[model samples]
Every structure is written in structure tokens, then in C-alpha cells.
Target: MAKSSRKANSGAFSRRKLLQGASAGIAASLLTPSGSSWSQSAQSERGSASAQRLAAITPESLPKAWSREEIQRRWRAVRQKMKEAELDCLLVCQHHPGEMISERQDGDADIEYLTGISLPYKWVVLPIEGKVTAISTNQVKGAREEKLSQDRGIDVRIVDGPWSASIIDAMREASVAQGRIGVTDLADASRQAEGEVTYTTYDRVLKAFPQAKFQPASYLIDGVAALHSPEEIGVLEKTTQVGELGLQAMFEAARPGVVQRVVWLAMFNAMVNASGERPFSVSVRADGPGNSALNRPLEEVIRAGQVLSQECSGCVLGYGSQVNHSVVVGSPVPADWDAAAKDSLDTFEEMLAAIAPGKMVKEICAAYDRRLVARGEKPGALVIHSGGLGTLPRGGSAGAVGQIVLQAGMVFDVKPAFRLKTGGTAQFGDSVVVTENGARRLGRREMKVVKLS
Candidate 1:
């Protein structure tokens, strides 16, 4: 992910100055604010300090993938989900780099999760009774990444000539051209907004396999992948600890006179240096003085009484865990805002307590929403959301009352950014997992507003 940017090396690198054009993650096309639906990315300025200073390339191996039996076990879980959906085979698509919300690096975890292989320009085809294949453009480019997955015992190959042609051949070889097939990125015939699959490619696939029953299978892939296995949870727990270390680094780096981006910059090496080689993603942006929620760095000099808010996460072997916080620069915290943040933390605790096997999604949502309302603060968009791959899926729609029940091993993220009586948002949260008893916190850090300066 750390390719050199020709433009970003102009002069003295000022973290705050990069805010004017720090690389923007995930354009509006891939995701709109009204809802986190798929869309495209925006044009980002090159030569940002992040691209040069905090590129997330590491040399380490924390993921000794599950054993061969375990890989088959997970594959069976995929088939079970497919059986429930009546799909004979599932075609999982990769996300455009523009679809990810990250600081500088982007990844495709859905593909990685299913095949245990993480390669770009690739597709994973999983048929009920055949070998699951990781389809890539070429063997040379992904040789290193391919070896990593091969070490874990998975089949990896390169598509000859056109990718569509290769895909058609693969399906025909498995005799699935005329059978039911599921493509995750197949947009509905109407809007058909360009996501990872362009209209031309979508039409080409349809034309190539005229009689195949192609359908959208994103829900099946996302829903089941959202639930973590025992081995997956073990990796996520390690990811959470790495995130805690990054947050701790951010806390230690925050002080009077420190640049806004310094907090984020500090996390770059601190995470990699400390964690060795766990797959991790870190993003920290300050909102005090010259910095907005969307912009990072801002070169804004930190002063007393300003708050630094951020959404930082990391993945151990591509199993993601995240945490959000708003740290105060100095004392005499605003009572109204403090109360709201405290209530946010309190509601988060309520959410963790409420998540248990067999509980309806709406039941847990309402249980926490009511607690926030009683405290005179409306619960934010998502009280709880699901975790998978490298992305955090907001479990269905936040505040959408529903009967979707929580089962053991389901993992979700909790981030509360509520309207404050004193103004602005009071944001804080962390990741958790649903076990037989209740939601267990994955992060190692304490749930309290930090006082750095």
C-alpha cells in the first residue's frame, strides 16, 4: 500500500499543512451519508504527509492461518449460508480502493476471508462441490501474497487473457454456467451505480453466461462473514490489543503545542513497531482549530481545552476490531459535553451487556436507545454494528427496528456520536463479540475520556 507519490515530496513535510489535501478515503459514490450503501471514491491530492510518513507496510507474520481442517470447516460454514440462500455457487467481488475508509492504505478482506488469500484485481469463486478458487489477473504480481495463502493451504491461480473469459471458463469447467450463481457486486437492474463492477463488465458476464441464474449475494456473504469463528476471534483479540497500543500512543503523544497530525503520525510507527506484523489500519484526525471531522492533520497547533476525536482500528490476519474516542487537551471539561460522553460510554456498556445469544437486533438496539434518551441525549446512528474483513458493516440500518437475532460468535462495532447540549458530537466506542453469555469487549483500553495535556 506504500507506493511513492511523486507530488507529495515537494518540501518540508508539515502534518498540519497536509489537511488542505490529505488523501480522502472512499468517495461519495461508493457510500452516501444518508446510508452506507456502495458508491465510488473521490479524487485525492497526492503528496500528503501520510503517504510518505505512515505507509502501513510491515515485515512480520502474526497469522498462522487455521489448519487445513479449519479451512474446510470455514468453507462448510460458507456453503451452509449459501444453502440457506438457495445459491449453488457464490462469486464474491472485491471492493474498489475508493470504497474503503482508511488513512492511506486500503484492502479487500471479503475475498481474503473466503479464500484465505488477499490479492488485488482478484475474484473468489466458491462452488458447493468443487475446489474454491482465488482468481487473479497474473501470477507474477501476486506471487508474494499468493505464497502467503498457499502456506495456509488454499488454491490460487491467475486468469489467462481477459478476466471475464477466465471467469467464464472457470464456471464452465465446474458446470455452473447453466446453474444458479451469486455475484456480490451485481447491482440491481435499475440504478446500477458503478461499484466494483462496472456496467460494461456486469453486462459482459450476463452475456457470457446467458442461461445462468445470477443474483446479488452480498447479504449472505456479509452476514455470515460478520460472525467470527473461534480462530477468527483469536486473531481479532490480538488486533484489538494492537489498536489499544496505537490509542495509547496517541494519548501519550497528545500534549500542548503538538501538531494535530502528530497524534496520527505518532500512531504510524508505534503500531507497526509495537505489533510487529499484524494486519492493522490506523486513522486519527483532530477536530480542534482548523481541523474538521473530514479533514486530517491541519497543522493546527494544539492548545488547552480542545478535544481530539478519532476512529482508529487494526486487523489481526484481516479480522477487524475498531475503537473511537474524543480526548480532552486540558482540564475544566464542559459539564454538558462531559455528561453526554459519559452517557455514550454508559450506553456502550449497556449495549455490551445486552448482546447475547437469541436476542433480537431490535431488542438490543431499543434497550440502548432508551437509555440514551433517558439521559436527554438521542442515541447516534449506530449503537452496534457488525465486523468483518477490514470493513465494519453497520449491522443493517442503525435505528431500524428489526427481528434479526444475535447469535453466538457474532461480532459488531459500537460507536456513539451523539448531539451534545453544549454543542458538537460526543464520540466514543470499541469492538465486541457475542458469546453464549453476552457481548465481550475486545479492546484492552479503559472506556473513559482521556486527559492528555
Candidate 2:
């Protein structure tokens, strides 16, 4: 189990600006007639801003595109899931960043994983049989849509109004206006409870398609998305390599007299230079002798005997892996601190041993708890959530969902968090994938407490 209190960094690609684009689209809807498209003037304003920003990076310069085979595999999996759910189509919303808890930095992982595009306020209409159309609010002269079509080889439709109206238009075009439609925002385990769609948007959708029966179908995608393909696993390995570099940079920069913020920036620069995109949360806990809380870098200088408890991850192509490590600045190491730290690593190893294919979710959690007890330590919350595209299943244990049989190709972020009687804390874990034999670590860092003299 890996537990964390993650913070969000909107990324260098201003997610707030993307939200503003969504707002602009919504505001444009008010200016237009109830059943009509956006006004010409309103479109020009929105398009210009997006176009200018997109001009900096050419399609050739973009990160390696997903293979056609991988796309087909994902489509087949999702369609099979849809078939099981007895749905005519899926209205998968791809909107503003940080909208979902698990997807705070990376925008909608479902769309990004499926279409390989990271644009905001877009809605994808995937029919049971036919072309998949992605409706975008910021398309000028079909240039943006055309670019997407050329890149992802999917149909791109330019919507001139809010996502609610746009989705209705797309559904009608796909001939699923009155069919069984599955909306993504309904309920995603842990990430979303009542769904991510606002009341206004859902109400508008309900009013437009009164005949269509809508159901919460986020699980349909969530289940399929959790199992990564071979291509995705390769990408995850590369992403973990980049995250390791960031961790190394953090360790090098952390020393007596250096501000915690400077150390964090050092890690950020190293990861970005290594082709990293979204940088997830990094907590630098150097409070005192018994540090248990995670926090952002402050102006306080690092003291000689202070213990630094840190957790961080670096994102690449919308994929990231986490690493939690701790260090003592100048050690005459405390025996109790060293013992607790080693026990955390031991607990993590035991948990990993129990994470093979066909294992039950409760079994893994039970193994984790038993190991802590064997060490004469009180068991604490452990997090063993899926790590893929970001918005996958999340929970204190295997998942918020009930007993699930572990399968090969499932990736998990397993961390065993330990809070000792001395008020000190230690969390040891890494990103791992379930294989036929056992779990494999994606982290390159050594799992142990470091003592710096």
C-alpha cells in the first residue's frame, strides 16, 4: 500500500489557461441563440489564442506518437467493455486540467490514453460502430482539427458552443441521440464520487436528449485503462527512468544550509531537461526530529541533524511513477530511526512478494498488515492504487472497489507508510507492474534510509 497527500502543479503548459478556454466557450454559448452555434467573433477570439500557443511546437517535434496497433488494442478493449455494459456509445469528456483528484496535473487520462491528444474542453463521441469524433471548442478554419486528425487518425469535429451543447450535436451526428449513452463523469472510484460533470452541464444534457438513457460508465473505461499494453509498459519504464533522475538531483541538492525550495527546483530542472512534461507533487518534510507531515518547500534552512522525508514523481507523455525516500543530514543516526526505516522497506518488499498475478486485493492488504505486526509495529494505511495515464483506480488498498483478482499488466503504486511511536515517519514504495511471476519495480533508486556524514 502506498499512501500520499499529493499536491498539484499546473505544469508549464498553463492548465489555468486551458480552463479559461473552457470558460470562453461557455461564455460564447450565452451570446448565441439557444439552438445555434457560437458567434463568428467569439470563435475568432478563442481560436487566435490557442493557435498562437500551438504554433511554437510543430507536429514533428511532439513526443513519439502512439503506435496504430496500440490504439486499436485500446479501442477493442473499450468497445468490448461497452458491449458488456450494453451501451450504444460512450460520451467521454476531456476537459480542464486538475478537474479530477487523481488527474490533478494531467488532464483527463481517459482521452489522453485513447486519443493521444492533451487539449482541454474536448468531448469524444465513440460510437459502437463507426468513426470516433472528437469535438473541440477551439478550432480555427479546421486547422487544429485537421492537425489532430492527421496525427491521431481520428475524426475531429469543431464545436462552436459549450461542451453540453456540443456533445448533443455530436451524438446526433453519430446517430446515437436517443440510444443508450454512457457518460464518463458519473462516478469514478476514489477520484470522483458524484462525477466530475457540473450540475449545469448534466442538466443541459438531460434536457436535450430526454429519450436517451444515460448511465455512469466511467468504470467501463477505468477497468480497461488500468490494464496497460506492452507499448504503454515500455513508455512507463522510460518515464520511471526520468523520475529517478529527478530523485538523484533532489538528493544532490539537499544539504545543510540549502533552502528546501531550491532543492525542489533542482529536481524539477533535471527532470524537465530529460524530456519530462508534467511534474507531480514533491513534499520536503524537514520539520524536526519526528517528522510525519508532508509539505511544500519553505524558506527555512536545512539543519545538520534534521531528517528529510521526501516523495516525488516526474511525468512524461502523461505518465509518471512515484518514489519515496528519506535522508539524515549529519548523522550520529538514531537507532530507533534506522530500525523504523528498515522496517518500512521490509514491509514494502513483503507487499511486493504478494502482488503476483491472480492474487486477491484483500490478500495483498492482509500481507501488508501482517508484516507490520511481525515487526512489532502498529499497522497504518497503505496505498496500492493503479498508476496509468493518471486517473486510474485509487484507494488505500488495492482499490476502493471490493475484492479484485490481480492480473498481469496491471500497474500499481505500492507504498508502505510507517508512523513510529517516536513520532517519526517512513514511507517506502515504488511503481510496480504485476507479472506472471511477481511484481517488478520501475524505480532505479535503492530502497533504504541514507545517512550523510
Candidate 3:
């Protein structure tokens, strides 16, 4: 039987409230059966078979894994880039030493890659010639560092002092006095230097050793961002699989008079029950008019003729992958919707085909513009969104929305969207990797609007 919509407490729905409500809806859906006869038959069979079940399994158990060698190889590449940049040492800090924000920073993968440790409020120093030391605020235990160092065959050091002092001391110990040291402080490092009297912590480090020159580490970071190791690929692939499965579950859970939160919960449950790692974001939308793009699922009940657009991400082994799809309930796909989705997919595929090593990013953007114009769509600001998907350090750069020059080993999510003449929009996206010859789709499924009526 179709489940009735859950009543809402009186208030405007914020994103958090929507998520909370959706979680409840999802729980309810799992407990209720669909009205379909096949569903009822399956329920009956499941009830009969329950007595023959085996031992229960816990999904929280992570698989025994080995990626130390892979991480080491990536670090070697990063070290090489540091050498090319003429850096004496590279410092990767998680949060500002004294002022820690509750929110996490986005680029911890780089630090995690260099050191086989995953924690915030830490600093990783990769000297051009010497050992790599991971300095932190004594929050990490000595035994953990020893195990990580032993597993990766690298030195991991724990410093017991203020963050700035530890950083300075590590540099001094590494003999980084007279050469250029690369710092990832894209902000506040300069002012932290007390004028010429005493340079900021970064400046102080340079002053403490007059021969050391301080330089921005963006280029070196970019270099590491461009490459991916095989182990990283494995993590990314697993994440993609998780995303696909979660999406399927969300689609199966959607129905008329069902709440949008129910579909979102179904997706989340799939990820959690599959033992997928943390850092997943799932969003679901129903067919509506104005401000629908920004509309998260609310207490409003889903109708039979609505379209559900779902975007989901799964992060496993510290790598992330995303998948998006639209599902229709009890209605044929609209002609305009079909055309818009097909054209978007076609444009995305064309962009993927154009990716190759050594192609200019600007040229790729221009091609995308030309193609969109030919298809009767206006190409606005084009940005390249391509990079490595790995637990190790990865970077993404903007290219044309329609086209981006490809580089071998670069993985990307090509999602091209267009504003439809009607009251809605269309979008399709897929993950692909650039190879020596061309691009390869990570997931084999064709880009199309899926109807589940």
C-alpha cells in the first residue's frame, strides 16, 4: 500500500530541518511495503525465508587494506616536484596553529598523502633532501605514528610544543636555513610576520635562517594535483560504485505521496549499510517551478507525476566520487526533457573526447563554446573541472563547461547543464579519465534520464 505523507511541525523548512525530516521519512519507507503485487509477493517470500538466515553481519567493519606502498610512491612524486621548485622544505598545515575553526578545510588529502596519517590540526614538513616529519599538537598518540611510519617505511615525528614553534624547529633541524622553503599559507602568513623587526612565522623562519627564501607553494601543489597513483584509483572506483548503488536505492524508494526526505534517506542508508566510509553528500529534488533548483526536500508530499533529481557522492578510503540522475514516477518522459538531457549528455561526451595530454585549456574552452552555439545554446563562462581522484593530494582546475583539454591520468566529472525554454533545466554528468589516446568513462552507464514509473 502507498504510504501516506508524514505530518510536519509548523515552521519554515531549513536545510537541516529538511534533512532531519527526510531521515524520518526514509526510516518509515523501509518499514512500509509498496502497493505493487510483486512487492507483496517478495515480502511474503522474505518472511518465509527469515527462519533460514545465517549470522548477522556488521557493516561498520572496514576491510583489511594495504595502500602504504601506493602512498609512498605518490610522496616520491611530490618530493620530486618540491625539488623542481627549488624548495628547501614544504610545510602543509591542516588548521591555523592557534585559531582552529570548527569547519574542516578542503585539502587534507595532500597532507594525508605525504604522511600515512589522517587527522586535522597537524603539519607535514617535506624537506627537499631529508626525512618527512608530521608535527601536530600532541593529539596523536606515539604508538599510532610508529605504526604508520613502520607501515609506510617513512619517518613520522610528533612534536610537543606550540604549532608555530614546532614548525620553526622542524625547519631548523632539517637545515632549511638558506634555501627556498615552500609554504601553503595562501593567507595570513605575511601579516603574521611582525614587519621587518620580526617576520611572520613564515617570515620568522626565513629570518631565523637568513639563507632561507620563502615562496608560495601553489605550483608545487598543482604538480602533485595532476597525478594519481593506482591505489588512489582503487579508492575512487569504490566510491563511484558506492554512489551508483546508493542512487539505485534512492530511485527504488521514490513514489507518489512519499516525502522527498524518504528518497534522500534511502540513498544515505544504502551508503551506510554498505560500509562505505564517511564524507558523503546526497541531495534530492522533486519537480516544481520557481526556486526548485535551490529547493531541498521538505515536509511537502511527493506526487505521482513528479520527477526526482538526485545527486549523490560517496567517499571511501579518503577518495570521493559523485553521480547524479533524474527519476520519473508514473509519467512518460517529457519530450523537451528528453531532448534537453540528450543534448546535455552529447555535449558532455564531446568535451570528454577532446581531453588529451598537452592540449591547451583555453583552446578546449573555445571548442565547447562553438559546440554549444551550434546546438542552439548559449555557452557562458566555461570552467575546466578535472583532476585526480585519490586519497593522495589531488587538484581541480576550471575549464570550459562544454570542453576541456585532457591530460593523461587526469580524472574528471563532466556535467553539462542547460536552461530549458520551459520552466525547468536539464543536466547529465559522468566521470571519465584522460588517457594517452582519448578519454575513458569510469562508469559504463550511458548518460540518460531514467524513468521508473
Top-TM-score candidate index: 2
* Model 3 C-alpha lDDT per residue in residues 1-453, reported as the tens digit of each score: 111122222344322233334454544456344544123333343243321120011122222233566656766787898877777788775422112211112335456556645444366777876677776555554444345455566555566654667777778888877778777644433122211112355555565767667766644654565565555555555556566656656655776767766666666765644433442446667663312433244576767655666456555544556566655555544556766667666777777777678775544455456656776766543334342323222122332222334457766565565444433446566666667787666654446555554
Q: Each candidate: what lDDT?
A: 0.57, 0.61, 0.53
- Which 10 consecutive residues of model 3 have the lowest summed lDDT? 50-59
| lDDT ranking of the models | 2, 1, 3
Better of 1 and 3 by TM-score: 1
TM-score of 3: 0.72
- Cα-lDDT of candidate 3: 0.53
What's model 1's lDDT at 355? 76
Over the stretch 1-453, how does candidate 1's per-residue lDDT look in tens digits?
A: 111111212344322223212322211111112211101110011122322222232223344343445556677888898888778888766753223244213355557667654346367778877877777766434354565456545556676666666566667777887888888756531112344665665677789889889887666655667677777776666666666655655665665677866666655444544344332455554442111333244476766555666656664445556777777655445556677677678767776777789987766766456756676655434556455564334542244324567788877677766654434456777878889888888766567665553
The CA-based lDDT of model 1 is what?
Answer: 0.57
The better-scoring model by TM-score among 2 and 3 is 2
* Model 1: worst 10 consecutive residues (lDDT sum): 37-46
- Residue lDDT tens for model 2, 1-453: 111122222333233233334334433332222212223432342245432332232212334445556776788899999998899999887532244223345456667766765555367788887878776665323443246444556777666667787777767877886889888866753355666667787889889888989988887777897788777776665566555655555555666777877766665555554543545545556633211223345677877666666556665556666666666655445456766677678878888888878877667777567766776755435457566565665454434432677889888777766654434466666888888898898765567565543
